[model samples]
Target: MMASVYDIWGAGFETTVATLQFAIIYLLNYPEVQRKLHEEMDGVIGREQELTMDDQKRLPYLCATIQEVQRASNVAPINFVRTTTEDIVVAGYLLRKGMNVIPQMPSLHLDDKLFPDPERFDPKRHLDKQGNFVKSDYVMPFSLGKRACMGESLARMELFLFLGTMVQKCEFQSVDKDAPPKIAVTP
Candidate 1:
């Protein structure tokens, strides 16, 4: 039982941390996005009390921002390769039963066809014209199907609560005013 707990925490909690770091990076890069986040947090999860998952409904922009962070962050760039249990045809390609299926989840998140202008870190993409959070089916940050990340819901909840609460009280800014914040690429 303890091992299971440790394993889940190591995998799940670490990814949440990564997502939060990415959120901070993006927030620093885009002050306008940070300002909007502050506005939403102020309106919904004010300084009076701590934010809970229940407040998520009232914070559509916060939710959309988190979704955008997850989409752009691409924490788990590649998913655990799963083998086909039986012969299957996907995208007009047939795969043998025992063939290993390597799913590159980032492909979906960064796909221009699914998400228009996939390069931009605009949370508005996750929101509808009416300003409501329109959860996109293509936002497969946690991936899709049976072998998807087990801690997806937990990660989302933690991101929303922790990021929401942090952004509510504090204002983040970049050190250099003139130059944009740089995102380092690493394996």
Candidate 2:
């Protein structure tokens, strides 16, 4: 029990911090994206109003931006090794029961077929023409399946609250406006 607790705390802390840092860097690299996020946040959540998880639905652009950040950052490229309970065949490759396999999450996030010009940092991919947040199966930052991150819900709420509040209260900019730092998309 204690080991599981430690794993959750440590893993959650590391990933969240890395993701937030990458978010700031990405925002700096793309000021227009940051401006749009601010516009959405200010419009949905007024300057004085506090942000909550309930606001997530109303803030479509914010949601899309966060999703884009997760997709572009690829913070956790590989998930924990999961063993198959029974024999299975994936992509014509046979795997016997109890065979351990790791999911390469970046492959999905950076797939050109799924996300055209995958390297570019555009959040519109996660939004529909009507400006609604469109959740994608490919943007699995917290992994997927039964063995997915145990703290997935908690981490998501934290991210929504933290990122929402930060954008509401702050205006991030590059230290050198003339030459913005390049974003390192890899984890």
Specify the highest-TM-score model's number.
2
The C-alpha lDDT values of all candidates are 0.85, 0.90
* lDDT tens digits, residue span 1-187, model 1: 9999999999998889988999999888888999999988877667877888888888899999999988888888887888899999999999989999877767788888988887788999888888899888877877778978888888888899899988988898777877667865231
The TM-scores, one per candidate, come to: 0.94, 0.95
Model 2, backbone clash pairs (residues 3+ apart or across chains), number: 0
Clashes per candidate (backbone, < 3 Å): 0, 0
Question: Scored by Cα lDDT, where does model 1 land?
Answer: 0.85
Clashing pairs in 1: none
Model 2 accuracy (lDDT, Cα): 0.90
Output the worst ten-in-a-row residue range by lDDT, candidate 1: 178-187
Candidate of highest lDDT: 2
Residues 88-173 of candidate 2: C-alpha lDDT, one tens digit per residue: 99889999999999988898999999999999999999999999999999999998899888898888888889988999999997
Provide C-alpha RMSD values for all models, in order. Answer: 1.6, 1.3
